[model samples]
Target: MTTPRIVVIGAGLGGTIAAYEINGAVGNRAEILMISDSDTYSFVPSNPWVAVRWREPEAIQVHLPPIFAKKRIGFTSAGAKRIHPAEKRVDLNNGESVNYDYLVIATGPDLAFDEIEGFGPNGGHTVSVCHTSHASEAADAFEEFCKNPGPIVVGAAQGASCYGPAYEFALILDTELKRRKIRDKVPMTFVTAEPYIGHLGLDGVGDTKTLLESELRNRHIKWITNARVTSFEAGMAHVEEVADDGSVKSKHDLPFGYSMLLPAFRGVPAVRDIEGLTNPRGFILVDKHQRNPKFPEIFALGVCVAIPPTGPTPVPVGVPKTGFMIESMVTAIAENFVEILDGKEPTHEATWNAVCLADFGDGGVAFVAQPQIPPRNLNWSASGKWVHLAKIGFEKYFLRKVRKGESEPFYEKLALHVMGIRKLKM
Candidate 1:
């Protein structure tokens, strides 16, 4: 009998850990391979720090080739050009193809900066910290801006799924400026598409609105919510403030010497626009088990997965796939594959909980939502200096796990179990 092959696409946070966990689960029963665009794995959560020079790019990056070889898994950086789900084959950019009995698609979203004119780092006036490379360039820009500080703008764009990093980057800039004693010369403004301060695409988990608002107030950061950025000029941003009825309430021309606005995200080119596989936004459609209904052999997790908005808002807001939530999906898929190999139907499901530690340079906010949506069983949030330390610890610990090729180590499982947090549904 031929050994079944399992191929995982993308090597970001979710895909890399999924490969490790799946390999451990299936053992020699199946062959495992990973396809990534680059051999280096970057910790994206650290990108905000990279922008302020708090973290060097190399500190958060890991070379995957050596580690995958050590784990006895096939690794390639050729990247997929397109996914032929009907034929169970993936076409690579290098004119090669690979067939798989089971495939896991975890390619993270593509930043949609072009949707807004002159709004990104490429040829645009604003800067970006979405990628490590972009963050490095932003650091250089930051250094130059500090020499002659004027005004700063930071926030998330309309339809943006991720918001924590925007909040983090904004506050981190404040902290850095204060440290440099140039904050008084710089006016900071936060502009967002959310109706209120901490909607965060999950509808204000546990007093997040009050908490985030207080933070901005204490820092003297003025904000405009329900904002739609129409365009960005050399030193000005055109914005329209939308009302609850979806009509334009006002408009403003805000001037800034430096800006970093998080862009909206869509699925990568490889698996986009497939009729049954993706939604209109190019996000993969998955059932409760994280398996695509149209192609049972295809599964997906992370930012690329399609999740409906929590509710209707004046501006479109997308739900964020937090790290722990993505891990829950990864664990569920690994367990499901094990059941399939044992001649049983796949039954495992992820808990999809959201546990986030949003670090601000000095202090931070932490929140936990049991199911990551509104009306959840557990909704808790807090803020303290300890949260910032916890975030740093998490970054180091996660990097250590990747280096050791370990997933869900014994201590981590024990810690989560003690806290009554689980990755898989009961």
Candidate 2:
């Protein structure tokens, strides 16, 4: 019998964990190879901390080559230039092609900062925590800004899916300014595309609206919801606030000395424009089993997968795929592949829930959304200093798991079990 070859693209969290799980499930029966653009894996959740200089970049990054070698998994830091699903081949940028019996694409998102004028870390009027390197740069900028505090603008741009980081950064910035005793000198304003505060692309999870609104108010962070940022100049941001009927209600020219806006995300070019495999925005479309409908041999995980917005707002808002939810997708893909190896059709489905932990500098908030939509089995959110500590614990635990090449840790299982939470119903 021919040995099955499995190729996983992008060594982000989803891709790495998928490779680990596949190795454990198939053992020596299959060949597992991982391809990524970079040899280092950075814990993205720690980026906000990095931005504030609370954590260093190196503390959150793990070199991939050594870890993959320890697990005896094939590794290539060179990225994929193109994927020919029809030919079952992935062309590497370094001039090589790898063919596979099955492929898992967890390439993550491509920041669409170019969508807005003067809006990204790269030669833009704003700083970003979207990448570790970006966070490092932001930290330097933040230090300089503290010397002469001015009006600050922080929020997510229109069509941005991940709003948690924006909210967290806003609160974290508030906390940081307070610590420096310069908050009184800095006027902060939040601008977002959500129809209201705390919508979070899932349409407000468990009193999230009231909770987040109160939190923002207590921190003195004024907000403008249903607002679209048209562009940004050196010291000014142009915003247009819209009503529910989709008409412009007001416009404002806000001034700022420092700003950080989460840009929109789209599918990376490698998978973008692929017929039937991706949506208009380049995110991979998958079935309930996490397998592409056009090609069962191909599957997608993480932010690269397409998830529709819960409801339409004045400005477009994409739904975010949280960390735990990505793990569920990874698990489902692994289980389905195991079934295939057993000569059975894939039957497993990811629970597709949302479990997010957003930390401020001092305290944090956490929410759980079973099925990731409204009218769910479990919908809850709470905030406290414990959540902040828990977030730190999660980062350390996640990095350790990557080092050990562990797909799922025992403690994580225990916690989720105690919480009556699971990856899938089965």
Candidate 3:
């Protein structure tokens, strides 16, 4: 019998994790082909540090060739332009094609700065941290601002999918300016579509609502929640601020010499128009098992999955899958895919389980909640020198393992259980 071909699109966190897991746990069971536009993986979680000059752009960027050689996996430095689910083939930007028995579309989100006029390729005015390039540009601008000293406004814009960066940028920049003794000369403001602090699009995790509010106050960062920025100019942000009584305030302008706003994410152009293949917003629709419902051969995890908000932004919000949860979902999906090919039914499901390490100005805080939703338990959070040291340690460990094609199941399991992605069966 011929070994099945497994094609993974977009070598980001989800796709890479899938490749490592399949190679480690089910190598002989399938032939894995990983496709990506670039040859290296950018460490996204550290982009905030790069924006504030804590990490160098080249430091977190890694090439894929070494890992492919050592791990014995096929790496394709090509972009996936389309998915012919019916034909079991993928289209490439270079007009080449690859056929596959199984397809995992983990290409992640395409930052839609275009949607927010004056951003992205369309020459949108605001700066962003969506990718390594964007982060680099923003960092350079940040340095210029520090040297020149100007009013700064940093926040996530309307429809942004990743909200953590906004919070981190605000805190990190605040710290950076203070270190230079120029913080008193700059006024920083946070603008967002989230209804309240810690809303983070997924709602709130643990005591996230109270936790974030308290932290922001302690750091002296002013915030405008429920704000929908209409547009940005060279030195001003025109925003429609939402009031506590659900009233709309018109055309309020916030001025700044430097700013960083997160953009909304849309699906890659290739996966568009595959009916029921994506949500209205263009994210792949997946079951708790992480398998595409429309096409069994397709699957998605991480920021690529389209999940409805549990409620509005102000409540305890929802869960985030930055560090731990993405790995867990990848593991379960890889194992489940192998089972189906082996004629074994799969019974694994991982919800939005997560343990997010958020960095603050002086230090950071780690939060974990089972199921990532309500009924919080076992509060295990701390801040200080150790937290910062551990954050750096984890990054090195993660990068090393990923480069070596090693899948750490212990972290995966802990992520699932701690975030309550898995509820213990009675």
Candidate 4:
């Protein structure tokens, strides 16, 4: 009897974590093949550091082959074109086909700059941190701006889920400009789709609103909240005031010499057309176990999940799937995959899950949500240099674990338990 082959699309956090866990068999009857469009996975969380020249993409990215080879995992670096889920075959960009017994569709979000005028695909008039190349360009743009100081604006546009980056870029730029001794010359403004500072989709996780607002005031960084950016012309950002009901009732314009507004995200093109496999917005809809709702043999995790709002905030709101939240999904997918293959039942309860990470730039801030977004218990957050150091520690640990094919059962269990707690169930 031949070993069953598992084909996983996308090599992002969720996809990579799944491959890491499933590469070794549950009981030695399966082989895992991880396919990705890129040879190396980018640490999207620190992409702002790349934008500000604190980190370089090449310094951060590691090749996918050696790690896969270590785990006896097969690897393919090609674009996934289509999936025949029922037939267990996936079409590749090279016109090749691979068959599998099980499939995990972890194709992460496609940064849709096109959603906002003057950004994405053709490249934004301003730089971005959404991709390594974008970050590199942002660094170059920063250098040019430093050589000739001018006004700067940074934030997220309408419909952006990852609002943390907006805050990160703003504070980081403040630090960078001050270091270059041009902070006073440049008029800095923090523009965001968030109804207010620190309302990072999780609804002001752990005094985030207070910390962020206080920091902005201390740094003398100006901010405009509840504003939806309309477009970017030569040197000005067109924006508008949004109604509490989340509608564009009024409009205005602002100017900038340097700006980095995170664009909206949508489902990747390859997974978009798969019938009944995705939500209307193209996000993969998953159950608590991270299994695709429409296809049991398929699973998804990370920014790919379609999570509706738990409540409303000041600006247009979307749920955030930060680092730890994604890791929880990875763990759930891994354990459940084992259960499904072993003919045993698996249960993953997602209730009170929180993301605990330090947001870097001006020192850093840490957030812990008892429950996700809002309606929490013990939502304590703080900022300091130690938080920044801890972030580095985490990056090192994550890279080592993935490279070594090791999963800490303790960490995984802690995440699940936290989620269970947040859900308010025993």
- The candidate with the higher lDDT, 2 or 4, is 2
Per-residue lDDT over 1-426 for candidate 2, one digit per residue giving the tens place of the 0 to 100 score: 999999999898788899999888888888999999999999998999999999999999999899899898999988999999999999999999999999999999999989889988889999999999999999999999998899999999999999999999999999999999999999999999999999999998888898899899999989999989999999899999999999999998999999999989999999999999999999999999999999889999999999888877899998998887888888888889889999999999987777777899788888888868776887888788877877887788788888878877323453354334566342
Pairs of colliding residues, candidate 4: 195-315, 202-373, 351-423, 352-419, 352-422, 352-423
Q: Which stretches of candidate 4 lie over 4 Å from their true place?
A: 25-27, 245-250, 313-315, 350-352, 409-426
User: Model 2: C-alpha RMSD to truth?
Assistant: 2.0
After superposition, candidate 2 runs with Cα above 4 Å error? 409-426
Off by over 4 Å in 1: 409-426
* TM-score of every candidate relative to the true structure: 0.97, 0.96, 0.91, 0.91
Identify the leading candidate in terms of lDDT. Answer: 1
Q: Give me candidate 4's TM-score against the actual structure.
A: 0.91
Model 2 weakest 10-residue run by lDDT: 409-418
What does candidate 4's lDDT look like per residue over 223-328, in tens digits?
8888888788778888887878767767767777888887777888777867778887788877777777677788778787788865666566677787666766
* Ordered list by lDDT, greatest first: 1, 2, 4, 3
Total backbone collisions for each predicted model: 0, 0, 13, 6
Better of 1 and 2 by lDDT: 1
Predicted candidate 1: what Cα RMSD to the true structure? 2.2
Clashing pairs in 2: none
Name the candidate, 2 or 3, with the larger lDDT value.
Answer: 2
